[model samples]
Target: METTDLSTLPVPLHPGLPMLGNTLAFLRNPLGTLHTLQRQHERLVHLRIGGRHQYLVLRPEDVKHVIQENHRNYGRSPAFEILKIFLGNGLLTSDGDFWRRQRRLAQPAFHRQRLAALTTTMIAETANWIVELKQQRSKQPVNMSQAFMDVTMRIVCKTLFGSDTTGKLDGLSAALDDLNYLANKKMLSPLRFPYSWPTPDNVRSKRARTQVDTFIYGVIEQRRQRDEDKDDLLGMLLSAEDEDTGEKMSDQQLRDECVTIFSAGHETTAVSMAWTIYLLSQHPDVLMRLQAESRTVLGDAVTPSPDLFRSLTYTLQVVQESLRLYPPAWIMSRRAHNPDSIGPYTIPAGDTALISPYLLHRDPTNWPNPDRFDPDRFVPGGPKDQLHSYAYLPFGGGPRLCIGNQFALMEMQILLAMLVRSFELKATPNQRIIPKPLITLRPNQSIWIGLS
Candidate 1:
């Protein structure tokens, strides 16, 4: 469908070497370089990442048109082919009817009722994290990134799979690390390093995938072998039948969905929590306000029970603001399935489109004092719905919007409330907080924070 026609859509060939189109330039400082391109070329800029034509979408209307109005024509980008190695045909990587069916099967598993039952699981996991911090109170400062990773890993495994799989937490963590490394490296690599090669990195990734698959399949097999009923997501999935076909997900289908959920479910939330803690450390007043809000809301109560944090407006606002600043899924991509006109440019069927939350979050036009840390931007008096639908996208928009949004939000809110209520975040005097862009935008180094 034609939206807007621009006979002269400026496609500047930014100074680059033969065969490579703005690859090195874009890689150096992704955000800065994209901003420069946006300024020069306006909302629709055609870039070549290693000779690959990539359209950088900046305007809110363009984003809405692509992601909301005509979403089906776009699927995950070819750049994410590396992710397919690990995730298989999971929700994040899959497209068309496969994505639709998987989403349908998995949606009910994370329904409010099911997630509400897992609130106790979140509390216990966060408490475990606090205990670890309390033990190291004087010994050494805690690494908030690693700590959050561990907490979310446990919570996701326990709540989604079952409590018994908690023993496999270390293996899952290692697998996730390996997957992240391979996926990010492949993004910038020209040769598109083959995972089948006998290289150490390839071998490690393959081995990590095997371990993760083993764990996932083990859970699937055990569920099948068991005659009795269990109530976790896995159990629910096995029981859930398609309304149209009245069919259950095959073993492989179930495993793919599990891996997708396990990967997207935990890692993104972990990154969000890590950034929230790190940012809070940088802004102590925000931290103090959060602590006061949490304590006042939960008075004398220590743990993060559902009743204690369900309506904690301030705490939720802080989490929302954190997501706005450092959205975990930094860049989302989609390739047109058909020739589509977006604003001034005509995108052919094979061309890929990208919506960068990184740029959207820091857009000067949308956010006032865009670089500052102000949770109040989301407070009551703040500009409500002023930002366009796709302007402030952290969880994304449209039919493919993260199905786990509520579950992730609930997990973050509960964990943030529980941790802030118990400890004051103290950042290291000269610690570095570099954003490592991978499957998610996470801290490159450990975020050192001391407890009160």
Candidate 2:
């Protein structure tokens, strides 16, 4: 790919307008655009968008090269600048040695032991939410999507932050929405305006950032002044010292990580559960089987042990399948620091690679009848065992893979199991459901449903 043949051969470009490239289509319906490209091009499709060299990597091995094999040579894309407004330089946006040190310091918080404790919190909080869900029952339609978002936020705040956002939910939700809009616009728009330009969008984004900063910084200050054993994520993050320097995270770093974790932890799991619920409602056979598994394995249980949670194979399969179809964090981008060979194409220095889980997961080559909702593919020794390592990446791959993978999965399993077991939720008739691709993929507007 990168040998002398590279100079003679050129990367194929996805067609676009003069100077604008695929910005319009990519921004209009990024998932749809990429999915269409996945069908037309081979693995790596090149595009020049507003003077930016963008490569849409479609195959697993090529994605592996960017995010794993030669990962050190690739850093997070500059498009993350928008997220930096609200997320700061947290794990999701940061790169290089700084990211490595931060990763090392934060790794312990998600260890198996810590995750087990978090599981208890997840189970308890989910149980409480289930009771509340039941209590709120009425003839009025319930938007389970928002309900999932609210419940997961509470669980994440309580389990990770050692506090909850009971009254702050509405404020936080609005702030998150505004920030999401700003981030989305920043990523897709042709003009790259400085966030400090004081335009309407900039002003709104700044206000949103201020609200988020105030909330997370307040949480960090509260934890710092506390004397209790701070093993909870927020506590551990506060007390964590770099093994190399014996220095703890700065207030900014802590706030960034807190916001990153909270934004990711609650939102990803909530959307995954929402999609899972929507899928289950559409597939009665899968729903019946999932409910049966829940009743058989977790009958009236407040908290199942890790081993017990793992025993629900079908339930776990359902969650995995749902994630495959509707990954929370749908797209990841990396910029090459040097010339690199990925399959047949050479990634030029400074070229940005877009790896989409949404695209890869739906490839018929990897998944037969890809769009069909089938959980059996994920059975322990089933079809999933044979897929390429990078083919099914709901939580992504490589060292920078999501640190909260286990926390997110466990929360999704527990909540989905409990929600489906003693309850019946049906998607409202004649409703349009589309995956709204923002910071994470979620249902457009509210997913109207009847919960009984």
Candidate 3:
């Protein structure tokens, strides 16, 4: 690697409105703004948002540098600091030794073998969802977004806590809705007041947080009182001990991890599945291919088994391409801990680096005809195989990559196989669906699909 003199190179800055700079434009359409920046400015572009200088990394090499090569020089940016309010010191928010410890303890639960055991749970839940859809018996438009959310939430709860949270799902959903809204608002606002201040939004946020905490703590307390050791993520967490200190996670630690899993685990997968279904509804050719593959691989089987899922290669490819277009974790930020070199420019310490997978996945340089809904891009000898390593990061890259990537992938594959095999989904005519870049890349409105 070559070092560049910080003073010698000129960083191109995106011009924006006076005073506010790109703040309003960014808040209005973050993904669009990012794509424009990548297209117009190329590799690395500088911007001033709310008087703060930030760098948008557009090239794969720079992204690799920021996230993998010199990751030690970067830490979770201020965006995640706001997330810490809801996530606490969980793996998503915590850094350094604490994060490492938590990751180690929680890692076993997401292992391939462990996740395989949960496949039956995932398939059973999807089967039940299929039954409910069939009972509708009409071409009634259903909100696939919410439908996916409901099913994924149940799957996560059962797999993680080893209990059915069907009754309490509404409370958890409402609390998460409030928290995500507040978190997004804070992230976009240039001047955010302290969370301690009892403003209306803050009060609502606090109440929502309390609701989430109460439910999580209640579960933890009940499990602690039980004498049996069950086989679930929560069970593993409660029984896990630090090899160095022989200590288990405290209640607060357990709460933070559980909340993180609930928020991060369920919502992202649900959104991915919803977007995939919507995309398939719009593209009949792709849907036909997916269904054909599903039927051939999962013939006469009530549900997808581990071996059956492996054989559904085309179905898996469709899921991959869907993720390419609508990655759940769209934008991630990292703050430079010390002055570091990213390509030609030397990023100053404390400057924020924004990496947008949503933009990168659509970059014409990486994916030709970037916006086209094509699953062949992920097939063998496909366009994806020709791209840079970090070009398509739905679950991100590096050691900090999403631990549950396998779990989420398997869950989505199962759902896609089961649902597509069971139902004929048609997009509601004249309906407009927009992608809203919140904490997750969610549909701005309900995705209305008429099921046969």
The model with the greatest lDDT is 3
Mind giving the per-residue lDDT tens digits that candidate 1 earns over 1-452? 87644744544445566777678787777767867866676677777886677787888889999998999888888876778887788777888887788788788888899888888788777888878878778846787778888888888888777746666789778897788777778776777656777887788888888988888888788778884467777788888888889888998888877887778777888889888888998898898889898888877554655777777888888898889888988888888888788655677778888788878888888888877888888876676366786888888888888888888998899888888888877888888788877668878887888887
Model 2 shows how many backbone clashes?
0
Give the per-residue lDDT of model 3 (tens digit) for 1-452: 99856654656888999888898988888887887787698778888876778999989888998999998888988778889986789988998788889888888878888888888888888888888878965757888888898888888898888888889989988898788888888887777999989999999999999999999999999998985588878888898888888888999999999888888778899899989999999999899988888888888677666678888889889999999999999988888999877656777889998898998899988888999988889988877888899999999888789988998999999999988888788888987888999888998888878887
Candidate 3 displacement at residue 398 in angstroms: 0.9
- Give me the runs in candidate 3 sitting further than 4 Å from their true place: 1-8
| Candidate 1 ranges beyond 4 A from true positions | 1-15
The CA-based lDDT of model 2 is what? 0.84
Residue 9 accuracy (lDDT) in model 2: 54
Question: Whole-model Cα lDDT per candidate?
Answer: 0.80, 0.84, 0.86
Give the best candidate by TM-score.
3
TM-score of 1: 0.94
Candidate 1's error at 132, in angstroms? 2.5
Superior by lDDT: candidate 1 or candidate 3: 3
Candidate 3 similarity to native, TM-score? 0.96
What ranking of all candidate models by TM-score puts the best one first? 3, 2, 1
